[model samples]
Target: MSIWGKFAGAVVGAYFGGPLGAVAGTVAGHYAFDRELDKEVAFTIALIALSAKMAKADGIVSPVEVDAFYRICRVPEGEQRNVARVYKLAQEDIAGFEAYARQVAEIFADRPKVCEDVLDALFYIAYADGTLNHAEEVFLRRVAENFALSEADFSRIHARHNPNVFDPFAVLGIDPNASFDAARSAWLKASRENHPDQLQARGVPVEILHLANDRMAIINSAWEMIRKEQFNKDV
Candidate 1:
């Protein structure tokens, strides 16, 4: 079963049993899930390390970010012990950092929506100590773009701490549409124009590609939200 499935199973088992059973079930389920996929364990560790790297970008890593990461992992004491082992393994694999990001991109690629969750959590960590520096913003923006967030989405999230503003609709060169089809057409056109892959093919740098990816993610998310809003109104 997938890691996500195992987590779901544990949550389900916990509810059916006493609190103690739930705790035990959650641990056992995670252990089984980890054992079934060696690569998954490694990838999880790598992701944590990546998070760590991002956290330290500003030359300081806050206690809150550390705690948030542990909270996200959701492991019991025994499982956490194992996770510590994996964490150490990840720290030693610095050469694999880029590869780790690539792996993560693949794992979560099909679910671009989840990238927002990840980014939100990361920002929670970044701002936990009540401040964010330029280095922190640089790394966070890079990761956000890698997930293909669009300009609107990026600006929305970016504005959280950065404060300086930009017009999202204008960034995509679109105006309020009288029809859904027009809105979608404009959004799709912007997406194709800003696609990271397309820019990369034209010899854009990795940093630029990352920027494009971030913009695309935001555009796609905004379009989806608009579509859903229109559909709900019609319903």
Candidate 2:
């Protein structure tokens, strides 16, 4: 079934907690059973499904957020309404977002990189209005937990969107006071994981995969900062 067909059917299950459910009701007569959705399809749907909830979590959905969201989703102009319909449906769905998060997590369970990509997409939207508010941060952290993302992992990703301070250690997902060798190892691992080509190879869709460019840039900037700090300290 197409992504919308699946969502149209998915309104029945609280376990799905996704599109079609009412702000206080369930998706009307639909498939009682869950269809096996393609990972790619699921990926797209989840983006639409959870986005409204994320925006609402912050208490205000700005025009800028909406614009950033469309750009991140990269839905073709022709298909914009279809994606918007799902986003509206999801916003109206009252089921806990945990169900939606779980569904997405299940599809990418064995594919952690894909899960991270999902988080990256979510982060992009959260920052769309120019700041990550308290509600949005709480909402995203829970989503990350549902995706089995570690606190350190979530922190590193969050640091990219919210760089209030130039803390290289947080960007590298390492302890600030770590030994030089430990920091170097952390940077190498970050380099390997966030390399644009490597992320694309991991099955991240092209639209979302380009986010790796930003990730790589952040890692590179963090590493360079740390490198200079270390070199000057040694000299």
Which residue runs of candidate 2 sit more than 4 Å off their true CA positions? 1-36, 233-235
Query: Local distance difference test, per candidate?
Result: 0.51, 0.70
Q: In each prediction, how many residue pairs overlap at the backbone (N, C-alpha, C within less than 3 A)? A: 10, 0
TM-score of each: 0.48, 0.81
lDDT string, candidate 2, 1-235, tens digits: 3334434334333223334223212334433434444455557667777777787786676777777788875666656665676677777676678777877787677778777877888888888767788898899999999999999889888887774566788889887778777887888998998887776666565666667887888888887777778644431
RMSD of each: 12.7, 4.6
TM-score of 2: 0.81
Error of 1 at 93 (Å): 2.6
lDDT of 1 at 216: 71
- lDDT (0-100) at residue 134 of candidate 1? 81
Give per-residue CA lDDT, model 1, range 1-235, as digits (tens). 4433433343333222222122323443532222222333323433455666665666665677777667655555645554454344444434433444454455556545445445654665676666677887787777766677876666555543332444344444456453777776777787775676654443332322344555676667666666676444331
State the lDDT at 172 in candidate 1. Answer: 45
